[model samples]
Target chain A: MRYAGPAGMDLEKMAVPLENICSQCDYKGTPDCREPECLMGFARRVLSYAVQKGLLDVPGASSLIPKGDFKHYYPEALVPALAETCRQCKECRDNHTPDCVVALVRSSVEYTVLSDSIPYPGSVFMYLARIKEQNPELAALLAGELSKKG
Target chain B: MGDGIFRQKNGMVAIDIVASCGVMTPEQLSGLARLSEECGVFRIKLSTRQTLVAVLDEKGAGRLVESLPGLGLKVSPYGNVVRAVKACAGSSALCPRAVGEALALGIEIQDKYLGMEVPKDFKIAVAGCLRGCTDPYCADLGIVSSGREVFDVSIGGFGGSSKPLHGEVVARRIKREDVFLLIDHVLNRFRALGEPGEKLGRAITRLGLTPFLPPAGVKEAQQAPPDDFVKFLED
Candidate 1:
């Protein structure tokens, strides 16, 4: 599964350590077979597994949280669904897994909740336009100067 | 950090240093331009080799060179660091005839030699193939691909201000493992007796290619047929 995000989405949090699964594979003790490429592939496979179970959120969604605080802004309903998925996945086992998808989702969700409390993008632009509108006298003087140059 | 900053005191000598070819990123160039302008520089020139040379009266030169790398662009004008290994934008991004990644290898050479002081400034170039979009004769060392996984490494080539013609084949159909070592040997020999301020081609002319020939057991020096040279990179 491909996880995509805009900001505040950390790829490191979704990654699992390859050493945990090394003992389970036949190539564990072989010097020739223990290549860096092979280890990197195993790590990628674990990420894919987490994505397949719908346990990870896309990267950009985490930025939706307000002020970097999750409790203040994330939707309440999404929290329980994320927790349930985390509890059911065996990939989240402490010893076998380096990272779990649930923890990542919870952190993202909390971030989103906090972000929701900030001013919307359009509102800031609107405020700037209002200030320009309020200064009509200064605007008229600037216009007069332009007309004189013309 | 020196007091002697190269700048145009009278502002009449409008010198424009251009960077034509190199591995510099766009942001790095933009920052360089801004910094140069701030230092009362006349103009920043971009060379055909993708290198950025800022033209200042001798005063601003020090500060510009010192600051550019912080923005990710390092000045490697005349000292070691594989002096501007030129490579065409090949099949990795563009170009239909490219059989292998010329830019990738060029980048590898650049990273490996970025700041290493050599006997003289050594230049290596990579072209997608014989089309020579990069003008193979212009580099001190040139690598042009023949086919899948094969490359032709040319030596004693150069271009731009005071152009010098490239010389005969030192090696042909070189594999990846041999390329780096071969280049290292070439550079090491050049550095051993290269006179200060002497260009690589000039140094080779003074020393002669016979002394730099590959060691015994390696293929003897012979003029490779154009077609055999074409497959040099593929083997």
Candidate 2:
């Protein structure tokens, strides 16, 4: 089924390596069973390839898997696995579950940071400094306070 | 209607009246509406199901309740008492899946819990089948028909400002004899551990079903009870 509004963007066109896509495809009936390291092996290789090609920014990426006593990250495993299969496929946009998760998280983060009025790190502080520079009385007070400060 | 003599913090002690279920008639309603006007109760709020709720000042509330029996109504709300129940017009009226009588069972449960206090508000909804036209899953306790004279009893369902979760069936194919006993078990269990302001669904979720189970080797306690409404029509 086609999702009309904001979900019209095609995600599968992003592309995954051919070898990785072949192994990840569940052609056999035992998709839910433990296939030793076959599934995880394919996932790790695909993620490495994406990072090496600079297609995915690893330093900025959030930790997809949780730490501690839990054995498996049941839902998070879907991220790389889905990204691999959807690579270069126009039909990726048709899949509701995976695409919706990424879209919602991105939208939420943007809404939280950009929509706030208070100053933040980097560019915002620079803008505040320029405003203070325009006000000579405030600037003199800051200069005197800095000279007298402990 | 006479002037009131006492007042309470919540409002005024306008009236106190009691009557059996099914005892009120149309003639009584007409008389009460007039008495309510005389007592100064200007409006009556019809509940979600089929119950009349009147809000009046102290004098009017007292007079309405006093004259209620003559008009065939009652004034009862609050406490752990089983309040009015909601049910859909079943097969007898206009539903296809009404194998069991929904309205009759609803009335039976209402009478059984009438005037009895529990730990919190207990709601009972009876639907002819799983279509849930009357919103069975929205009640704290619910009964949905599976077949003729057969029903699945569900517990811990509720609906309001927050979304409601559908209940799980603890028993199935319940016969009429065990209906009241099942209700008694649930009510007594709730009364034992339920804290003030906690609704029946919240209490059940907190305590779980282990406490409500029958003790080992008790034959009658082994199975869940049937709903009385279906039994009434079967008989």
Candidate 3:
């Protein structure tokens, strides 16, 4: 299963010590890995690592919700090694990735100020976007918390 | 926090490893790989401008930059500055088709002009022959070698913009020695004419190439190829 998101990468080859949430994703093995920062091409590498580590039959994507201790296992920013993916992307010419929290939050700050949405800041999408930009480390935590509400 | 080091969202710093003319020694490359491992960075990026980029913590970034000079590596200037010269492997006792000293001339240009402040980023490319492996035609200032001793200098080329344009020839069949003088004149003229935030290309487009061209007698006859060039071609 290929978990496609900012934190998604083969567990074995991962340089950082983040939890291998990608191994247990339901969307792992799906073809919808269009997210710019996701390492979708590492399926073989992940499988090899899984086999070696005996991490087969991992849980679904939902089971890995609310990744805790954002500081310890937060999705890292895209490194130059993965820059090839961005080089081939059309969106990167104009719109950067959501995981580019600093740039995104800085731009969103200007957007929020210019639109003057202070009077009617009721959009859930806007809230998530802001949170993701301001503190990507905690955005997943909030998402996990929100999922428990319904 | 300094030149060539950009702070990333993850509180890490990205460092640009300057490899002039896209060339790096084996020792330098090995040093870079070792640095990556020490910093816990597994990947080193090759930037479009022929430099390496690595991401690491602030402390590691500082140490890496400090150690770069020992490995014959340095950082490129960010923002509006003259970038490192781009050149093809021409006539370097290596490339057979090359008729000009591409690497030597590119190094000369880089030593003289790299990191000079400009209104916008300035690019320069040197091609050894008409094959234009360096794509000189698309740089802010371009030099194409017609022969070992002669060159064609073009100005105001622009690429990677919404309105990309090919530069116009300003000096035809100039001598090897005149290239630097012409560059000096171009930079001076650009500084004088360019408006704030205007690129050399945009300014040239609006003002015209007449301002950048060399004196009428300085350039050889436009229609005639130099005798040496014809001889080189025949051989």
Report lDDT (CA) for all predictions. Answer: 0.49, 0.48, 0.58
RMSD per candidate (Å) reads 22.8, 20.1, 21.5
For residues A5-34, could you state the per-residue lDDT of candidate 2 as single tens digits?
A: 222333223223223433444542465422
Docking class of 2: incorrect
Mind giving the per-residue lDDT tens digits that candidate 1 earns over B1-235? 1121234556422232223246556786678768878766766566666664456655656676677557765555453445566778754345433545677777787777654666556666788656677877677777776544556776777675665576556776566556677777777777776776666777778888876665543432322322322232122
Q: Which wins on lDDT, candidate 2 or candidate 3?
A: 3
Q: How would you encode candidate 2's per-residue C-alpha lDDT over B73-176 as one tens digit per residue?
A: 55656556566667765544444225456667776777667556776767777887556767877777777765445566777777874756676666665654
TM-score (0 to 1) of chain B for each candidate: 0.68, 0.73, 0.87
Between prediction 1 and prediction 2, which has the larger lDDT? 1
Residue B9 shift from truth in candidate 2, angstroms: 13
Tens-digit lDDT string for candidate 1 (A6-95): 222333433432233334445557754432224222233333443442323221222221232212212333333223323333332221
**Candidate 2 deviant stretches above 4 angstroms:** A1-150, B1-25, B91-97, B161-163, B213-235
User: What are the runs in model 1 whose C-alpha is more than 4 Å off?
Assistant: A1-150, B1-21, B24-26, B33-41, B56-63, B79-82, B118-120, B159-163, B193-208, B215-235
DockQ of each: 0.01, 0.01, 0.01
lDDT comparison, 1 vs 3, better candidate: 3
Candidate 2, B188: how far from true, in Å? 1.7
Task: List the candidates ranked by TM-score, beginning with the highest.
Answer: 3, 2, 1
For candidate 3, list the clashing residue pairs, or say none: A1-A28, A1-A29, A2-A28, A2-A29, A26-A61
